[model samples]
Target: MSKYVIGDIHGGFKALLQVLKKVAIENEDQLIFLGDYVDGWSESPQVIDFLIDLNKKYNCIFLRGNHDALLCDYLKNGNYTEEWFIHGGKSTLDAYKTLDSVTITQHIQFLENLKDYHLDNFNRLFIHAGFTNIKGIEFEYFKPLFYWDRTLWELALAFDNNLKVSDNNYPNRLKLYNEIYIGHTPVTRINKTIPVNKACIWNLDTGAAFSGPLTIMNIDTKEFWQSDPLPQLYPNENGRN
Candidate 1:
């Protein structure tokens, strides 16, 4: 069975469907989604519904993204921040308007149950975002970093560029896993439209929340597939901008 890791979807349901079809995932395959499944495009509810159904048919691991957490917070506490609304949360709220209470509750339950990170038997670590202080598989008490940290990716890039070095010859976090896969920070910020690999960390979020395509990678083979650029999929929208 093959193992696949998908980047942040960010409510691009059409893009998500295209990438899944491109991959042609089998029942035996393990699909790991790095989260940000909602809050960018016009179909946040549809994306969540499809994912719930997908979990019933496939071995899927869903990680919780910062956006997903913001959704949860809004659902449970009626707390809506301007920052959250600006960052595609408005679209998500609009999507839920047509759904009934039962469906919305189910979606909330699904989001609430998502894992923060996943560790495979192959020593690969899958997380929505990178961690800071980690001891083996255990991260520090700062839970928000699980879905909002950018410094970890910066450190990886710094190390890759030889800007940072250690006497032990490897970053402490990199030593814990054979490889680490993450999403959350789009690769486009670094001026790339594809996955970026620095040190032992592979960033899979190809900026589908904005202008790039969603990416899926075969973990073992390192083969990958990407959807058409998101702007092309939904030309009328500016996607979180």
Candidate 2:
């Protein structure tokens, strides 16, 4: 069975559907969803519902994202900062208004249970963001880095193309895993709307929360599929753009 790594969804349910259909996923396939599942477009609640149902039908690994953590905090404590509200949280809160208490509770539970990262048998690491510890994830002092750090991505981006893995100067973090797949920071920031490879890290977030499409890639083949841009699919609503 094939294993596919999905990018950040960010409430683009229509875009999410489009990419999944384009991928033609099978029941036997394993789907690893890097987070930011909610907080962008108008369908944050719907996205969570669909993911919950989808998990029942397939093998799925869900990673926590910074936005997801913020949403979880608000859901549990009814506390939200202005930063969270302005950064797509308003749309997410609005989406949840129609849900009943039971549904809200279920959504909270789902969000709380999301994994910070997933390490595959092949030593490929899937995380929402990045870890800073030179030794690796297990030794990371700050757990939130799994869903919030940008340094790892920046380091990868700044890596010298001429450097070999065997070089002593190669970043220690890049050598921790065979491959590291992450979301959280959109590749669109670098002017591309496709998954990008830097060093041994694969950044799958193609800016689904903004103008770029949601993406899904086969971990083994590097083959990928994308939806139409979120702005096109959700023209009526300005998603986190």
lDDT of each: 0.89, 0.94
Per-residue CA lDDT of model 1 for 57-163, tens digit only, reads 99999999999999988877788999889999999988877889899899889989999899889889999998888585474678778899888888887885553
Q: In angstroms, how far off is 76's CA in candidate 1? A: 2.0
lDDT of 2 by residue, 184-240 (tens): 999999999999999899999999999999999999999999999999999899889
Off by over 4 Å in 2: none
Best candidate according to lDDT: 2
lDDT of 2 at 172: 92
Query: What lDDT score is found at residue 34 in candidate 2?
Result: 95
In model 1, how many backbone clashes occur?
0
What TM-scores do the predictions have?
Answer: 0.95, 0.98
